[model samples]
Target: MAYQVLARKYRPQRFSDVAGQEHVTRTLLNALAQGRIAHGYIFSGHRGIGKTTIARILAMALNCRTAIGTEQRPTPEPCGVCESCTEIRAGNAVDVIEIDAATNRGIDEIRELRDAARYSPARDRYKIYILDEAHQITDAAFNALLKTLEEPPDHVIFMMATTQPEDFPQTIRSRCQHFSFHAVRFEEILTQLRTIAVEEDVIAEDAALALLAEAGDGSMRDALSIMDQAIASAPLDNGKARLDAEQIRELMGSVPNTVFERLMEAISENQSAPVIEEINRLINAGNSPSQLARQFVRYLRNALMARIAGENSELLQISPDERARAARSAMLFSEEDLTRFLQVMLRTFDELNYRQEQRFHLELGLLKLVHLQRLLPVEELLSQLPAPTAGKGSLGGGPLPGTLPRLQAAPAPARPAAPAQSPARPAAPARTEAPIAEPTRPAFSPFEADRDRKITSEATTPAAASAAPPAPQALTPIETAARAAETRATEATRTTETRATEKMQPAAVVGVAEPIAEGALALAAEADTAPEAAAGGSLDLDRIREAICAALEREGHNTATALLDAGDWKQSNGAIEVTLAIKKTMLALTMNAEADKICRNTLKQLGVGEKLVFLPGEASSAAAAARPRAAASGSVQAAAMENPLVRQAQELFRAEVRTVLDLRDRK
Candidate 1:
């Protein structure tokens, strides 16, 4: 006899020998045990997942001669030793007729089958008609057999095996007992392959068997056939076939997933040059662009599954090694990124089918992965906008983005160095002190009414301001007299308790920006003494803006309140104006009619000026070269463009206004 392939040699001879179709097998066994065999049966599933095999086994189980005289078989499984079972297993059973419906699927064939079903078994207990690929039968042929099939003779059994059960007429299917089978799982197929390898004396690596099983794609026969081909080509060592993963991959012309793993790593690291170089190398090495993209799509799918269900889960059909590699690749990206990569590669694979330049398209797809990694949403970029200070995102508060608070906790003045022994610290790390300490000061927001609540006592002390000036500090008599009169007037206005407190004020106060620079201290001293060079003029105007914001909050104008409160305040020409530090493009949103109304009511009540004024903050001004004149679009878009807050928002987020909806008519 010619050497048989693994699929034929290992073909299941009994229902009990079948794998991954327990539902159909168990049902058939029970029916045979109870002597309740049906006249007609339909077995349907994937092409190689035991549809025809189970049909043949069921025939043997029904006609096995072990229980020829008995009412029911003790074991529904075929007795392989019996003549009837042996003949059926050998495919030469006299009573069993196997027809390839694909070749003879006309009404004439159906009529002949109908005539044949009328006869009894020649020798076995029952005659069986097995039609393989039954779906190939025409609708007319199915109709011709429908009557006989609805009531087949008791001594005959009709078994039809098909991959596509839907193609059979509803009449034919309704009359038969339909058993839908499922594809064998990865583990089951792998287990079966391992058993075959051991029995065949093939020394195969587990990874090689895994590769065959994955290639099988849920079909056991497909896996076994691949294994048969692999064994023939596997190099012989000590008269035993030796198989490895790389050998199997070479045979299949599939790139190892590790190659894709490396590609993904380069992509995650934004190494576009390396990514393109790798693709070019793979193409130069005789890897087909289409095949490479196909494998990449599979690799990406596995990575996506590994991302969702973890690397060790049953959800991934890959072997343990590939699963691990896929998981490592998945870890480099977020779940969304993995999903996006999968979608991109899937489209790339699709494009490879008809495109003339497969190499260029595949490289473009891989490059897209690196490009997608750099994409930032407008909202995210806006969130990353700098706060008050450079490299710091906070305005004396933690609402903004930055790691200053966490960094300050480590390098703060209170945290001593590990090897230090002295209580007094050196100024070696002094530069680190100025930046980390200033912005996170919680009480120093320029927006709040009590921003001066933690004023430095030494910087504001009248007595300290009046201390004797050195000879280097030139001062005319008029300047000296003016300073004296200023100090005296401040003293006269203060109570006795206030005067004594100023005399003893501490150098630093808690919650103030710590480690104030010497230059700032001198500047504050000058402002306090001379009262001539204060950068922000007097505090009274600042007080006026705060009062108006507070009034708006009380009036339930929270939007206006937050807006006005986040800005700087200045009074000029007897008019109080608030400079809101909102986003430049979104400046339009802040200047809506509603804002205008709130501003008018609040500033009017404060008696600052007739018209409420809004000044763009420094960030808003810096975003655009100058405020753009509103274009002549429709009123809604024109208004959106004209509103200072909306324009400020556009600039802040660095987003373009794609479409504007008119909600005036909408509820």
Candidate 2:
């Protein structure tokens, strides 16, 4: 006999013989025994999953004539030895007609089949028609058979099998009892492969058989065919056919499990050199880069499933040894790291088809995995950082903690007074005098000693300011020193102004040009000494309110300042009770905490005793008091422009007032 492929030689003859399709088989068997056979039936599922096989079994049960007495009736289990059963299994039965819809899919073929359905069985009890790949039938053909299919003769049974049931029209599908077949499970395919290996007397390792089953991808027929090929290629050692993992790997052009294990180990250890070496070895061995990526993805998927579902999960399709290995490997990587590695490999697989340098992409992808597995999660790294400390000059203030304090300009050295010139002869010009030698000062000093001396002289001696200094006939070092001092003073003033503008707030800028006098510094020092005395002495309600508003404006709290400035203040029970308009209530509530701190600090600095209190009042009264009583719109604009707060805001924001509105007019 010619060599028959394992797929056809082991074709299922009875319902029980079909693997991984018990649902369809059980349903058909019950229908046969209960005498509930439908005139038309459709079996739909993926290829090689027993859709056509189950259809043939149903046909055998319908037409079998070997059943006698109690078995005479329609039997679920057909005896394959009977003449009718044997002929049907052999595809040579006269009564059971098998048609390939792909070849006979036109309207004419369907018409012929429809006409033939009217005839009784010639050799069997019932005429059975099996249409394979029925979805390939033309629309016209389906339309032609619609009526006949719905009302077939009593002795005829129509059985159709298709891999794609969606291609069949609803009218055709609704006329038949549809049964959907599922893909065979990994375990089921593996078990069947093992059985076939034993029956063929081929020596194969369990791991090799498992790989064959996985390569089949949930198809029993494909697994059996692969096994048959493996057996053919196996070399006989002492009359025992030898099949091992190495032979399987060579036949499939697949990387061995050891290579994947080494690669994963290198990644876990963050060793890029080993990973690259393994990839090069696989490439030199003729394994395609794209195929390597796909296989690695499969390995990662198995590892992930093993981690999440343990070794017992039905989703994992590896042998016990491989499963245990994956579980141990999974512990070396975090879930996040595993997920990232899988994503990279999958993306690399997709890019391989479009990329010209596929090997380079694969190398870079594996390198990325090696580096990524060594990274700690963000949460873990954050937990390792030192906690922030709390205090002034710590990260809890205006400036960031650890920043250097602002530098102060040193005072200029004192210079001796110039000697009095003789009045008898014409006095030498100021420029002819020798220049004074003064100690060097920092470049940031705002003023020179010469300017200060001149100012003091003018202040003390009114007559001396009116008399101009005499000009010298020849240039002298003394006069040159004075000129240089003036230039240096000007440059220093410019530098100080620039620094202040960059660092200080708008309110602070207002006083940038005003130098703090010795007397004022003395008063500030005193105030710092006795805050309570200062607060009690300056506790006037109006003064306290103004100080609070000024402090708020300095901090860029314009809205809060406006709200506080518009409030009506009254002193009662050692507290300043301020009533705000209804519209400002929400603003006050939002800024309560910040405002309280600012108010307390300002009162302490101003030596004010009164505590601040905020209250919401009727809009009518508050609005009447807050509104500017301007006689005309021009006056309102003038007042708004003249307001110090508005001027500061304009300077701070570099904005201009577009329009001004009168609150009274609004009412």
Candidate 3:
């Protein structure tokens, strides 16, 4: 008899025999017992995970005769002694027609199947069509079979299996019930391999069996195939099929724990020579490039895990000796160093699959890692450079808030191009005019020096009279610094605003540079609409009340209309108010000040102004005794202070307190 391949010989004959597919098997069995059988079905999974095998078993179940009587109906499991089961086992089941869709994927084949699907079963209870690799079928064939799949004969069932479900047409998929099988777990694969080894009477060590399991990569068919290879290669000195760890390791071409330890030691010392030697040894020992890459990635991963936990080696999947070696090696380097090595290994591993110069790529990766300690952390890198002297204002605050204290730029002599290296290897100091201190200055703002120069230059020279450094007599150093920063930020803001206005302004006005005529017309219209706009560059309060009234009235808001009509507005130093029937300070406080500004400006364009004075008609009983004005001002200040967006904008842009405008005023 011809030798049967392990894949076919160990093929799961029943649902119970199928490994690592309990959920799928149980669902199908229950469906069959409940008579909830669908006419068309699709089975999907990765290669060698039993997509075809499951489809075949499902076919056998559908056509099974010697049914086990249950409380409701017969279950999905078919009795092996039945004629239907015998025929299926022999691959000559009359009712269960198996088709290899890959080779026979034509419209003609599908048409013939479609024609045959209409007929009753030849002998069994159900006519089953099993198409393996159904995704390989041509588009024309799929289109031809779609109608039959959607509404097949009562006795005809289509079981289509494919490794690539995504490749199948959506229409065909929608017409069938779908089931996806996942890769078997490592434990499950190990259990199955052990059972097979025992059944084959091969004396295999647990470690040897585990090695075979790992080599299988979560596939039973793969596990069996690997086991067969091991069995064939096993020593038969005593006419016994016994396998030892040494034989398994030799056959697997796995680097021994000693070699791995040596490599680990080299990595920890940042020595490239020993690492290269190990790679060469592995290559000479017949380790495939892909396998070597996988091993390196695995080692890096295990090393990281071992480093983090600071415990025993049992947690890692690698051998106990390897884990111990990794733990020791992990102690030799920092997390950052290990991270760099992992990144290099990953890049090299990815390149191995595509690049012709595998050794060069791998060696280069190793060499780069050997020198990885030279690279500094991001913060260190930035702090090493002399920060630009008061660079343009950043949108968000520089770096993260509450980050590490800013490092003072070392005196040019001691500050080399590179940052302070690992303590063991201090960088050579640069030649400079000044002796470097041990970074004692607290948070040096590069802006401080520039601001000081600007101040001295302004105090002595007359060029900056218009720019106007505030009088030196009035301000302290810190206040002066704050003021300078604010002035610079404001000037930067004004420049950007000017550019934006230039872009948006009409060509004729743009040529005039300032657009004075348009500004005058806008100013006039604004003053007419919102009289308070004349006070500053923008609108004040009264116009906003009138605009709100108009808008609310247009929207059929009568209450708002009456309130606005009767409301009295008053204007003060920089604020305005409109009297309201009720006093809800909290509600009023919630109004966005920026949105109010936009509304006020918009109303000013319509020739409306004054200020929106909201007088509390029903004054609180404590108003006179407690000072309502002070309380109200405090509330508004508190509201602005609590606003995250406002606070962020104020701090980020260094906006100065110019004036606070109230939304109430009378014309």
Candidate 4:
């Protein structure tokens, strides 16, 4: 006989000889023993797994002469020594016919087969027809043979094998029994390869055989085919062929996963130079950039799987050595980090498919892995901030609500730029980095030190203020720091109000260059609103009320403005009192500090003092003491610009208030 490939030589001869298909085999054996043979059968599954082989075995069993009578044959298996079984096994039986559906897939061919299946068996007890690649049959052909397949002759049997059971029409498949096959597993393939090696007298190392089994990827026929090729290329030792893992890998054009694991180690360490050097060396050794990228994607996928499901989990489908190596690499990264690395490599593999500069893109992808390892998640950054203190504000007021603490910007020394190195490998890379200039520390900040001193000087008594800064009691460092921060925050707020006041006024009037509470608050309401009421200027009580009402409307306090406008507004000692026309309960709800926030903000905008008081009464003139009043003229904007300070600004800077935006919503 001519030299036969191992795939055909060691093909399964009986149901028990097949590996990893006990489900299909056990059912077939029971059916045969009971003589409950089906007229038609379909086997479907992955390529190179015994779909077609099992179909042939079934044909032999059905036609075996000695096994026809259940009394003669002790087992359901075919007696290979019988004339009918021998002829069927050799593929020349008169009644057992095997058809390749890929070639004869037309309606004409199916019609011919249907006509032939009607006839009685020529030699064996049953006429069996086997169809391989049955999925290739056209819909018309399947329709043509549907009736014949559904109701074949008593002596006729049909068997079909396919990889895609879904491709067959439901009509054709419904008339047949489908035996779905599973891929042969790793251990089964490994055991088969070992048995084959020993039978062939090939001296294969254990690692070499393990590599062949993994490369098979769960297909017994594929593994045997590869082994046949490996043996052909194996070097001779005395008389037997000697196989090594490296020799098999070279023959298969595969880079051992060890190379990829080394690359992963370089990436986890963030060693750019090593990653680049390794790629250069691999390419120099004749590894294609695309192939290397493809291999790396597989390696990264395994590592990510190992990170998520432990190394021993079935999710990592690899040899024991590879699993251990994957676990080691997985330890170097978080699950998220491994996920990102895998994503980058998968994209790189796809790019290498059509990219002109494969090597360059591959190297850039590896460097990206090194860079991605340096990223810090937002949650981690937020975690580094100080936690909020419970109870009162740092300055002992209402609680401060937010995720972050108040940050203090101290004068930090300019840090000399450290030498360039990978974050994962603190000592490597050694590339030159630009020096970071030290931050300049001024003697005093325009807002901080000066403002603190100004606050200290505003005290009624220096000893009273210096002895105890807190109103209630002395505080710890946390509390004291909180108080100082609160003071700075308050200073910033007052400074903002002063700037707004100055904008409404011009340079001629004394615009609030200081905080309103300092000295600006001492002025009467008319002096603050109507520029004519400044220290020596003249402004009427009615004009002050109009200005305050207009300001309230601008601040979105329409209800307050309408109600307060109905009442008489009087200004005395910088305090504006509004005696509203409502019940006492309604009075408190409408005028509490929180509810009256709009009124306070409006007063501030008109440059009036922030103090406001609400009383319940009617708006008739008899409800309050008399105060001089004047009917105001001109629009509110015109009056604002009429301020001496505002007119001065317009004249000096040639500016005008083009538009105004309410920013309190965001605040």
RMSD values, in order shown = 18.6, 22.2, 19.9, 17.1
Question: Model 2: which ten-residue window has the lowest total lDDT?
Answer: 518-527
Q: Rank the candidates by lDDT, best first.
A: 4, 2, 1, 3
Give the winner by TM-score: 2 or 4.
4
Worst 10-residue lDDT window, candidate 1: 518-527
* Better candidate number, 1 or 4, judged by TM-score: 4
Q: What is the lDDT of residue 548 in candidate 1?
A: 59
Clashes of 1: 26
Q: Write the per-residue lDDT of candidate 1 for residues 1-667, one digit (tens) a residue.
A: 9998899999998787899999988898778767787889999888799998888888887887777435454577777778888898889998999999999999998898889878888898888999999999998998898889888788888899998998988888888899999889999999999999999999999989999999999999999999999999999999999999999999998887878888988887678998899888888989999999888888888888899999888889878888889888888777878888889999999999999999999999999988777664345434534343321222233322211221111111121111211223222221211122122233212223222222334546778667835323334323343343334333322322343444644221111111121101000010121122123243355445556555554444444554554455555532234565543223333344444444445544544322234554443333222322233445444666676765565567664442233434333
Q: Write the per-residue lDDT of candidate 4 for residues 1-667, one digit (tens) a residue.
A: 8988999999888888999999999999999888889999999998888987887788878877774456656787787788887887788899888999999999999999988887888877888888899899999999999888888889988899998899999888889998889988888898899999999999999889988998888898888989999999999999999999999989977788877778777876557898899889989999889888877887888888988899989876577898998998888778888888889988888988888999999999999998776555456435534554432112232222221122211112122212222223322111112123234443223233222322223465878778865754323223343344334334534654545545543322221112233111111221234443333343244655666666665655544555555676665444455666654323322333333344444455666532344555566645432432222366343454455865565566554332222333355
- Whole-model Cα lDDT of every candidate shown, in order: 0.67, 0.67, 0.61, 0.67
For model 4, state the Cα shift of residue 542 in Å.
15
True-vs-predicted CA distance for residue 512, candidate 1, Å: 43
Q: Which ten residues in a row have the lowest lDDT in candidate 4?
A: 518-527
lDDT accuracy of residue 373 in candidate 2:
52
Q: Residue 584 lDDT in model 2?
A: 21
Residue-level lDDT tens digits of model 2 in 379-415: 6435534454321221222222212211111112223
Clashing residue pairs in candidate 4 (N, C-alpha, C atoms within 3 angstroms): 414-438, 505-645, 505-646, 506-645, 506-646, 507-645, 509-645, 532-537, 532-538
> Per-residue error at 141 for model 2, in Å?
3.4
Which residue runs does candidate 3 get wrong by more than 4 Å?
70-75, 286-290, 302-340, 379-667
What's each prediction's TM-score? 0.59, 0.59, 0.56, 0.63
